[model samples]
Target: MSGTSEGPTPAADLNRAVITHSDLDAPPCAEPLPYRSVFAAAPLAMAVVDPEGLVVSANATFGALLGTPAEKLAGSVAADLMELTSDARSWHSYREVLGGRQARLRCTRRLKHPEGHSVWAQVTVVPLPGEGRGVLLSVSDITTRRELQARLRHLQMHDPVTRLPNRTLFFERLTAALDAESYERGGTGRIGLCYLGLDGFKAVNDTHGHRIGDRLLTAVADRLTRCADEAGYARANTPLVARLGGDEFALLVEHSTGTEQLADLAESVLTALQGPFDLSGRRLSVSASIGVVERHAAGTTPTALMQAADTTLYWAKADGKSRWTLFDPERNAHRITRQALASTLRPAIERDEFTLEYQPLVGMADGTLSGVEALVRWNHPQFGTLTPNRFIGLAEEDGSIVQLGRWVLRTACRQARRWQLDHPDEPPIFVSVNVAVRQVWDSDLVTDVAESLADTGLAPHLLQLELTESAVMGSAGRPLQALQALSDMGVRIAIDDFGTGYSNLAYLSRLPVNVLKLDGSFVRGFQYEERDADRPSPADEVIVEAMIQLAHRLGLTVTAECVETSAQASRLRGIGCDTGQGWLYSRPVPPDRISELLGSPGVRTDVAGTP
Candidate 1:
C-alpha cells in the first residue's frame, strides 16, 4: 500500500495489515459479525447511546419495543423513551452513567410506546469500550411478570371469597398506624376497631349449602364496605374493612376522634346489616354483634387491641345479640380475674386449698341454733380468701364443680361427725352443703353422699344436700332417680335459693325436697324500715307469709336467707319461717367458732349486719 498525504503513512498501513491478518487467522468468524448478529436477533431490546444520551444505534428489537422503525430511533434522546426519566432522582442517575462516573446502571421504568400501551422495562446500561464513550443499553419487558407478582400479593393480603382485606393485611395496617402514632409529638392519636360477628351465621351454613353461605358472606362484605366508606369519609385514615375469616369481620379506624365516633360507626354497620339479603331468590335475614374498642395509640399493640375487641364482642353476644358494646376496663378486669381464677381452680382442688365456713341456721321460733350451712371458700394464694360468688360459676363452667362438690360433701360430713363427737350431749346438728347442678348431672351424687356418710359415721339425715330450685325442677331421668334414691336413703334434700328460678310450685310437690331456702331477693324488701306506722307490711312480707304457709302445707320447712337486719329477722320470724340464716345471726365463721357456739349454753342472739 502506497502512502497518501491525507491518509495513513507506510508504517500505519503496515500495522493495519498485521492487525487484519491476525483477526482473519485467529478463528472462523472473529470479526464484529457475531456481535452484530447477536445485537440484531437478541430477544432483549438493545441500543447504543452517545454521551449526550441521544440514541446512536438501535436494533430491531428496540424498534419493536417502542413501536418505531430502527432507523427512525437514531438521533432521538434515549431518556425520552423512558417515562420515569423525567423524575429528578432518575434523571440524576441517568446523568451519572452518561457522564462516565458510573460504570453500569440498572433500573426499572415505564416505557411509552407508540401503540398507546405502556410497558414496564428493566433497563441496564454499560459504557462501550471505545473513544466515543457511548453506552450499550438493554431493556427487558417485565410487564407480565410484574402483573403476576402483584396478583400473588393481592391473594396473600385479601380474602378470596369476600374480596376484602384479610386478617393479615388488617393487622399490618393496624401495626403501621400504631407505629406512626407513636412517632408523633405530644399525645398520640386514638385508634379504634369494630369487631363484628354475624349472628345465626352457623345456622345458615347448616340449613343452606356452603356455596349459599359463601354468597351471603360476599353480600355482607359489600354492605360492610359501603358502610365503612360512608363512616370514614369525614375522618382521617379511611377505615380498613376486613374479613377475619368465617362470618367475622373487622373495621380498623386510625386517628379516631373519640368513642362517640366509634359508636356511630358501629351503629351504622348494624343498620346496614339489618336489611334481608337476597341470595339466588332466597331471602335470608341475619344480624351482627359488634364490639368497639377505642384508645390512644401510645401504649396499644395490635394483639392487645384485638384481644380487647374480642372480649367486648363476647360481652355483646352475652348481653343479647344484634347490639354493640364498648370496651369497659372495669368489666374487662373483672372478666380477666374470673378467667385467672378459673385457670387455677382444678389445681386449687388438687392442692387442698379449699376450706369450709359454717353459718348458723337458727330456729326462728326460739332464736336457737338448729343447723349450720357449709359454705366453701377458696384460700387462694394470689387472691387471698375468695368467696363462692367469685369462683363457683367458673368451676361449674370448667366441669371442676363435680370434684369440688365431692370434696365439700366429704369434708362437711367429717366435720359434722367431729362436732357430734366433741359434744355428745348437744342435739345432732345437721350440715347443709350446696350442690351444683353440674355435680347432680355429671357425678353420682347418691353414691358420693352415701360414701361420705359411711366414711364419717355421720347419719345421712344430718348431711343435707341443698340444690337450687331450678335444678330440682329441671331434674329428670337419672338425676331424678338419683335424688329419689338419696331421699330414700334418709338424706335430706332442701331446695336452695327458692323463688330465684323457675318457681314451679306444682313441680316442687313431685321432688323429694324437705326444705325451701327462700332467695335473698325476697328478704331484701324487708330491709327497709317501716316509714308509715299505719302502712301494711311490705309486699315482700306478704309474699314471704304466703310462701311460708304454702311450704307448711306441703310439709316442707321454709328458711329465710340473707336477713341483714334484726327488723328483717323479726318479720321473717313473724311470717312463720322455720329457720333463719344470715349475717344478722353470725357471719360464716371457722369450724372452731361453730364449736364454741354449739358448746355455749345460751344462743348468741346479738345480730350484726354484713360488713
Candidate 2:
C-alpha cells in the first residue's frame, strides 16, 4: 500500500481494488504495501459491504465512529447501524445503490452509536466493480460543525438575556405570515398582535440594581412564553412571543379568530403579570399595558401594523396602565391627523399659515359688543381651515406652544391695533388671547406680551389673556408671578372655562384675575325657548346666578359662554352677567369680519332677542 496513502483512495481505485479480489485479500508483506493495508489504514471512516447490505469489512476509523472494535463491526447489517435507514426512502436508496440502479448515493443522516448518543454524519455509498457487487461506504461525523452553526443562528435570532426571539425574528415571521398564500387569497387568514410595555419598569432598575431588573425580565419572558404556549394549544397556529428590546414584549398570532380573541389574549397576559416576581430573595411587582391589533393579513405592511400597535399601546397607557386597548381605525386616523398637524405646526408658523378669528363678546346689559376673543385658526392646505381645538393641545404637548402662542399674541395685537385705528369712533374692544399652561411656565410670557404691545402699538388694557381655570388654579411661584407681572402691566387676566376645574374659590380672591368666563355647561342649561310665566327657569339658573354674584363680590367681571338662545341672553342679563360670548353674538369670524361688525350700526341691535 506504499506506506498507506495520505487520505482515502479515489472511487476508481477502490473499484479497481475490489475487482482484484486476490490483491485485496492478500496478506501484508515487508517487501511492499498491499491493498488491504491501505484500505485498513485509510484516514476516513470507511467500510466494504456485500450486495446483501452486510458490513463484510470496516476500517479502524469506522469502528471508532460506531463506538465498536473493527473486528466486531464485520458481519453486522449496515442499515441497522444508521438510525436514518429506518425511513422508507433511505431503505429504497440503499437498495438502489447496491442493485446498480444508481452508481453513487450521498445523504446526511443521524447514525446510532454503541455508546448511546446519536451521531450526525454524511454517508456516501458507491458501487464496487466486482462480480459480488460490493459497495464502498463512507461516514463523516458533522455533529460538532452542525451544532456550531445552530448556535450562531440561535444567537442571531434570540435575545441573549431572556433567550427569547428578538425583534428581528419577530418581524421576519410577521412578514412571512402577511405574505402567505391564504392571506393573498383573502381567506379567513387574519393576524393579531399584542404589543405590551411593562409599566414602571424603569423604576425597578432605578430602585434596585440592573442585575435584579435583568432577572425580573427573564422571569417575565418565561411567563410570556408559557402564556404563548397555552394560547397556541387552544388554536390551530402557534403564537410567537418575542422581546422587543427593553421592557417591551410582543405576541404574534398568525391565525387570529377576531378582535375578541386578541382581547382575551391581552387579558391573559395582564393577568399573568399581575403576580409578583421573585428575584434574588426579594419580591417585586410589575404590570403591563397591552395594545391589541387584529386585522386581515392582506394589504397590511409590518410598519403600518406596528405603528398602529404602538399608538394603541399609548392609548392603553393613557387610559391608565395595566389594561388592554383595542385598535380603532377611526381613532387612529384622528391621531394620525393630529400628528400630521403637529409636524406641520412649526413650519406653519414659519410660513405664516396661522390666522386669527375673533368672536364678539357682547355686554349682556346693553347688548353692546364689548370685546373680541382672539381665536387662532390654521389655514391648512390639506385640511382646510382648522380650529384651535384641532392642534393647540398638540402644540402644547410638543413644547411648541410657546412659539405658536407668541406668534398669536403678536399677530392679534397687531390686528387689534389696526382695528383701533380703523374704528376710532367705536369703544375700545379688547382682544382676549387664550394662553396655554405651557406658555405661562415654559416661556417668558410677560416679555412676549410687552413686546407685542410695544411692537403693535396696542394698549395693554386692550389685550386680555385668558387662562383655563385649571391653568390658573395650578399657577404658583414663577407662573403666578408671571401672571401678576402681566396684570400689573395692565394686560387683563381672565380665568377661561370657569367652574369646570378645581374652582379653588379660596385662592380666587388672592389671584390677579379680572374676569371669570363661565363654562358652556352652565350656559347650555338655559339654551331653550322662552318659558311661560307659569314655567320655572332651568336649574342652571341658580348656579349661574350664584357664580355671577361671587364674581361680582370678588371684583371680577362675569362672562357667560355658549349663550346661543334669546332665553339664555335674557337669563344672563337678569343674573347681572357682565358679558356674553357665544354664537348668539356670532360664531368666531375673520379679523375683517370683526371690522365689519365694528363698522355696522346694527351690531348692537342684532341681539339674541332683537328679532
Clashes of each: 0, 2
Tens digit of lDDT per residue, candidate 1, span 174-223? 89888954538533388899999999999999999899999999999999
The regions of model 2 sitting more than 4 angstroms off are 1-40, 45-140, 155-163, 166-169, 181-188, 202-223, 273-286, 474-477, 505-508, 527-539, 599-611
Stretches > 4 Å off in candidate 1: 1-33, 46-118, 123-138, 181-188, 205-215, 234-236, 278-284, 505-509, 527-531, 534-538, 605-611
lDDT of 2 by residue, 480-597 (tens): 9999999899999999999999977768888999999999988886644375653335566777788889889989999989878776788789879999988777888777877777
Q: For each candidate, what TM-score against the reference?
A: 0.81, 0.75
| CA lDDT of each prediction against the hidden true structure | 0.84, 0.84
**What C-alpha RMSD separates each model from the true structure?**
8.7, 7.1
- Candidate 1 TM-score, true structure as reference: 0.81
The whole-model C-alpha lDDT of candidate 2 against the native structure comes to 0.84
Clashing pairs in 2: 1-33, 1-34
